[model samples]
Target chain A: MKVIVIGGDGYCGWATALHLSNQGYDVGILDNLSRRYWDSKLGVDTLTPIAPIQKRIKRWQELTGKTIDLFVGDITDYSFLSQTLRQFEPEAIVHFGEQRSAPYSMIDREHAVFTQVNNVVGTLNILYAMKEDFPEAHLVKLGTMGEYGTPNIDIEEGYITIEHNGRKDTLPYPKQPGSFYHLSKVHDSHNIHFACKIWGLRATDLNQGVVYGVLTEETGMDEMLINRLDYDGVFGTALNRFCIQAAIGHPLTVYGKGGQTRGFLDIRDTVRCIDIAIKNPAEEGKFRVFNQFTELFSIKDLAEMVQKAGQAIGLKVEIDNLDNPRVELDEHYFNAKNTKLLDLGLQPHYLSDSLLDSLLNFAEKYKGRVDKEQILPTVSWHRK
Target chain B: MKVIVIGGDGYCGWATALHLSNQGYDVGILDNLSRRYWDSKLGVDTLTPIAPIQKRIKRWQELTGKTIDLFVGDITDYSFLSQTLRQFEPEAIVHFGEQRSAPYSMIDREHAVFTQVNNVVGTLNILYAMKEDFPEAHLVKLGTMGEYGTPNIDIEEGYITIEHNGRKDTLPYPKQPGSFYHLSKVHDSHNIHFACKIWGLRATDLNQGVVYGVLTEETGMDEMLINRLDYDGVFGTALNRFCIQAAIGHPLTVYGKGGQTRGFLDIRDTVRCIDIAIKNPAEEGKFRVFNQFTELFSIKDLAEMVQKAGQAIGLKVEIDNLDNPRVELDEHYFNAKNTKLLDLGLQPHYLSDSLLDSLLNFAEKYKGRVDKEQILPTVSWHRK
Candidate 1:
């Protein structure tokens, strides 16, 4: 079956491309290398300096005898997106194209506008293309845990069946995201849901959390297949930042009292979840949603976990409680039920000591490239 | 007190401008005349062909001796919006600036894209400008009743407190709008809510219903002060369309079983709601919402009312149930609470027999201008 990944250069996108192609599906990748440009702008490169998209696809073909087509373009260009959909007629389309950083969105007015436009317009274009050309294709979109924020109750996958005032109905979970980027995702989800209702198109929205680790089967053969290891404040994930902090002797920065907790999964597991979603598409007119994370951890718990993990590798990692740059609850109740992905046979890899060691080893090789200035929070939610 | 009204040329916008200005406030209108162009494109001038913005402002100045400045530009233009915000530095901003037609949104791909971009980007520009220039400005934006399609239970103003699995939190209701234009409103509301949380910029999103009638104080002057009233499908409200159908001896086009009930108020009451919302500004960091309508009526009931009222005014009317163009629950439950505005001292003018008679009488004067082609459903939600 033909498969096209819209944002096939990011952390999870690259891995999915390689794995799907290796599994004998016709796979193609489309991206603008926006995250790379963002990293370059911030003077932060991924840890191993992986080869570009062409080289990555070429190396994957050489190693696994599987060819993955690659194209560099903005999917927000609706005509281009429509042409791609019409040409490929893929059985499934994986959408990961969006501005995915909260702090980057909070940086300035330009970044904020860019985030809103890129995230929303990109999703709209993809949906428009699907409706125009490949209406039968299952669209598996990557949503986020941030859309739910820190509500006092347990978060259901993407919906909650409520029985209020003696009437029962299943409704999508009410969202209250924390940042512009997250808010845009909320918008995309709602728009897609509306499309599904109106057009009877098939779609899968995986509300995944903070993804960590970067090992795909293709990574084992060639370094090009290894996922991006962005370790800067703007481009990096929580775990990636913590690892770099430990390596560079910078404090493992914890915001406020550090009781803010969230669900997370390995990058590999994200690919696995997408694979499962593609294999089992939702019914036409039905919006299937899965809470795609395995476990949850607070910031303090994660920082201390990294600190201990670093100590095991002969690196003393100090901790610091910085004034919280973001305006969020330091301590709150958060219990989201991510049972859907698990039920879909996601054998999740928890954030173990071994995984931390592997991450550190990757960072240690590029210790010289770790710019300490990029480790601090450059964007604040509160305007001072 | 100073107030800047975005989309100030709209029905509610103009009415609010006149109402607020009469209440002794410095009011300036910022509009791009997108609605006027939409009216032109649909080949239906507002049933009452009112004067243009400049002429209306001139007339308001001449008659009431009240000077309300006019800034003619799209709110989507961030620079223009920000400059206007800075110049006015108004304590409150009435943001009625959005593409509000459901049938127009469903017309085609081009219309959908236009509605999404115009509505969302316009709201985003307004929000960012508020954050950058005037954080203290209370933004009163126009949301819609369609945002809460046909839910099973009672709908609160802007939020509902849900007790889920032993935990309770108030959330903006799980919006499931049925149209691209309404979907845009849902997305923009999320943006406004997020902006309020991050920037502490107060905003009131008035989730109003279809506004009918044209009898505000300033509109009493002449054609210049007379508010625009569209009676065509593209820009017309259901009641306006029914009224026009009565005037032209055409069928009142009701979709499907015509059991789709919704809250509705008068143009005068819409103006009243905005003035009340401005008087009771939302606190910083609060997303104040009010369901600004008085009574509810199904589509069939509205058509019957118009037919009966028009018969009293010596006009024949027919009620025709055509194929439903939109994908919505035709016969479903709709009970929305609108006590917030009433509590804010809005004595709602419910849809009465005399008011319906008055509406029919008003339409008879413009009986020659009613175009029969503009009265039917010109858009469909079918993807095929």
Candidate 2:
């Protein structure tokens, strides 16, 4: 089967691209490399040194003897996007090309506007391109688990069956995104669902949670094929930041009461979930949604886990509480259903102590690259 | 009270600006004049000949001695929007600045893109500008009833209280918008809701229904100040088009079974609702929603009403059923609660025979300007 990955240059996208190529699918990557540009603009580099796109592709081909096609262009450009879709003629398209940092989006009006335009408009182009050129192709879009904020009710996989006034109907889970970036994802979900309803398009929206870990099966093959590890306040996941802090003997910075609970998964599982979604295509006229995370952890829980891992490695680790930069519930109910991917035969790699030790050891190697200035929260959700 | 009316050259905006000015509010208009550009691009003019914007403003000032300040610029430009907000120091901002036609949005990919970009990004800019420059201003956004597509259950104002598994929770009403234009409104609602949540900004999203009628109390003052009456396929509402068709000795063209029910109000009620919203400001950190319509009618009901009105005026009006150009439910249950606006003291203008006759007589005076080709549905929601 042929598959095209729209944002195949970033962390998850690059890892997924290698995973799919190894599985013997004809893989083509289309990316604008905006993530790299964002890094330069913010003066923050990844903890792990990621090779350039051309070199990564070359190394992947060298290791596995698989040719992964590359097309570097913006998906917001319709001519470029449509031409790529027409030339590739893929049966499945994985879209991850978006401005994905909530902090970056919240930094200023310009960044917020860029995030909205790049994410929502870029996804809209894909929907139209599918409707006009590639109707048969299955669109597997990466939505965020953040779309369903901290609602009191259990977060169902993409939808909820609400019984109101003695009548039952299933609707897309109520979206209460906490940040502008997540709001953009909410917009994409609504737009994609509408396109399916009106045009009979097939789509699978994977509302994935925060992903941790840097080394995937494909990325571990060579030094040059390494995935990015963002330990900065802007792009780092909570667990990843804690692990990095733990490695350097710095305090695990816990925001607020350390009570913000969220679902999480390993980088390996993210690639595996993409494979599962591609193999199990949504039916025509359907916009399928899947909650794509393996386990849940509170900030306190992850902090303790990192402390334990650091002590096991004979390093002293402490936990520090900081004022929460974001305006969110310090303590809230968060139970999400994530059984869809498991039902599709995804063997999730939970955050084990051994995995934490491995990640800590990896972070130790990149300790010199860690910018201490980027480790703390700089952008407050509230205006000064 | 100082108020800024964005997009104050268009149908609802112009009327609301005049209404507020007559009520002694300091009203300023900021518009990019994109509506006029759209009219030129579509090669269609308003059935009622609209004077140039300068002339309309001049006439309003000459008659009422009210100076409505005008700023011609795009709201998407953050600098221009911020400058206007700073200069006006508006206590309230009415946002009607959006691409507001469903059929125009469905014409092609370009239109779909333009509609989403203009509407969603423009709204986002407002949210950011409020946070940065005008933190205390109340934002009154004009949403559409079409944001909630006909559902199996009854629709609430902006939220629904659902009882599931012996637990009840009130969530934002599930939005299932039909067209790209309505979807843009949904995006705006979500964004504004998020902004309120995180930034403590105040907003009122008026999910307005199809506004019929042309003359408001203010628009009736002078010929140059007449509001636009669009009878074209792209921008015209069903009731307005039916009345125009009857006036021009053409059949009232109802699409398909003409059983598509929608909530509606007069142009006068729209202005009244805006006034009510401004008077009743949403609480800080609250995204208040009000259903802004007074009556419900199907296409067939509207066509029959126009037919009777035409016959009363000694004109033979026939009803013709054309194949539906849009992909929608021909017959569906639509029970929407519009009590919020009523509770806000909106004395609605019902569609009486006198009212219908008045509209038809008004349309008849400009029947020669109505292009027969513009009356028919040209853009199909279905793929070619």
Candidate 3:
């Protein structure tokens, strides 16, 4: 099987690309390298030092004897995307190529507009390209768990059967996304669903939870092939940020009441989940969705867990409750169904099982690279 | 009250601006005049001869001695839009400025991308401007009923309360829009809702149905003030197209089985709905929605009505069922609740009462301006 990873230079994309290559599938990486550019623009670096894309791919080829093809371009450019797709002709396209930071989007109106236009137009171009050229290719899109936004009802897998006023129909689940970036993902889901209905295209939307840890099997094989670990307030997730804060002896900044709950998964499980999704594709003209997460935790729970793990490793960890920068319910009912991926033969990995070895130890190793200024939230949801 | 009517140079916008001006409100017309440019690009003309924006406003001032200020700029340009808003300082902003044609959006990838980016980004700019400068201003945005495609269950206003898994919540309605144009409106609705929640800005989303006829009381005052009537395939809707075909002795083309039902209202009622919404503003931080249509009709029913009205006026009329250029259900359940606007003091004019005077007579009076080549559908939902 042939697969193309769209944002192969970023964190999850890099890990997933290597996993696919190591599994002996033909794999190609298509990225514009904007993730690195954004880091430079924001004056922040990943906690772990990472090699350039070419050097990383070369090191992977040297160690594992696997060649991962590379196509560097923007997906918003339809001609470039269509040409790349034609050149690589993959059976599955894993799209992880959007501007995926909610804080980055809420920084200002310019960032908000750029995030939405870039993400929405990029996904739309791919849909049109698939409709025109490769109708048989399966689109494995990366949506976020944030799209559901803590609704009172249990979030089903992408849709729910609503019984309204003596009638029932299974419709796309209602979305109340918090930020412009998450709203862009919601927009992409709607556009992809429409394309499937009208043009007979197949798609699998993986509404993924917050990803933690820095090392996958392929990335950990050699030091030169290490994955990027973001610790900044803008691009970093809660658990990863907490792990880094504990390592550097900085207080874990818990926003608001620290009761905000969300689903989470490890990096190893993320790569494996992508692999499982590619192996079993959706039927032609079907738009399938899966809630891809293993466990659930609130912000305070994860901070306390990190504190305990750090104390055992001879480091004093402190937890600080700060004002919330986002406009969201600090305490709400959030029961989301994630049974579809598990039914497809995915063995999950838990955070407690790998906290010391995979997360805390790695953060301790890179304590010198931590930028303290980027530890606290800088972008407020409120308008200036 | 002071109000600014965005896209006030176009068909519905033109009539709406004049109506508000005649009602003793301080009105400002902000338009980029892209509607005229698009018609010239497509090599089509409106059935009614309309003057330039300046000439029309000038004529209105001469006839009624009411000064309507003009601001000629695009809403997508943030700096220009902000400057215009600062100069006008409007208490209400009536946003009808969008690429509002479904067929135009389905022409190709370029058209689809253009439609979504133009509409979504333009609305995003407005929300941000309101948040930064005019949080007290009410946004009367024009959304489409097509955002809710024909569903098995009845369509509510903009949201529905669902009972699922022993829990209940009122969430934004699940949208299944058919065209890129309609999907853009759905994106705008989500963005506006988020803005209202976070910034305490007020907005009213009018999920309007199809609008027919050409004359409002204000637009019919003078020849130069006549509102433009589109009869081309890209911009002309079903009922309006049938009226023009009946006047020109051409076959009234009904797509497919013509059983596709939809909500509709008169052009006269459109102006009144805007007036009513402006009079009763939504509360601050509230994202209010109203289904702004009075009645429902199928395609065949509209064509038959046009035929009867035309034959009674001594004109030859015929109906032809052609293959549908768009992909949609030929027959489906389309019961939608539209009592919100009527409850707010809207006296709707039925199509049966105004078919002869408003629509058919206008088509007959301007039959010489109709372009025969522009009568058939040129865009297909299926990709080439």
Name the best candidate (by lDDT).
Answer: 3
For residues B268-321, what per-residue lDDT tens digits would candidate 2 score against the true structure? 999999999999999998999998999999999889888887898899999999
**Which has the greatest DockQ?**
3
Write model 1 residue lDDT over A1-384, tens digit each, in one string. Answer: 999998888888888877777778899998988988988787777766778888888877777778777777888887787877777778899999888899999888778778977888888788778788778889999899999999988899898888778887888899989988898888889889988888888999988899888776667566656677877777777887898889888888888999999998888788888888988899998888888889999989999999999998999899999999898999999999987777878798888999999888878877887777777788888855
- Cα deviation of A71 in candidate 3 (Å)? 0.9
Q: In model 3, what is the error at residue B226, expressed in angstroms?
A: 0.6
- Candidate 1 wrongly placed segments (more than 4 Å): none
DockQ of 3: 0.88
What is each candidate's DockQ, to 2 decimals? 0.75, 0.71, 0.88
Q: Reference contacts recovered by each candidate, as fractions?
A: 0.70, 0.62, 0.89
Model 1 C-alpha RMSD vs. true structure (Å) is 1.3
The runs of at least 3 residues in candidate 2 whose Cα sits more than 4 Å from the true structure, single-residue gaps closed, are none
Chain B TM-score, candidates in order: 0.97, 0.99, 0.99
Candidate 3 lDDT tens digits, B196-305: 99999999999999999888899989999999988889999988889999999999989999999999999899999999999999999999989999999999988888
- Over B1-384, each residue of candidate 1 has an lDDT whose tens digit, in order, gives 998888889888888898889889999999999988887777777788778899898888888899999999987788888887888788888888888888888887778778888888888888778777788889899999888888887888888889998888888898989888898999888989988987898999999998888877668757768887787767877897787778778888898999989898988798888888888889999998889889999998999898888888777788999999889889998888998998889998889888888777788788887777777767778887
Q: Sort the predicted structures by DockQ, highest score first.
A: 3, 1, 2
Chain B TM-score of candidate number 1: 0.97
How well does candidate 3 match the true structure in TM-score terms?
0.99
User: Model 3 off-target regions past 4 Å?
Assistant: none
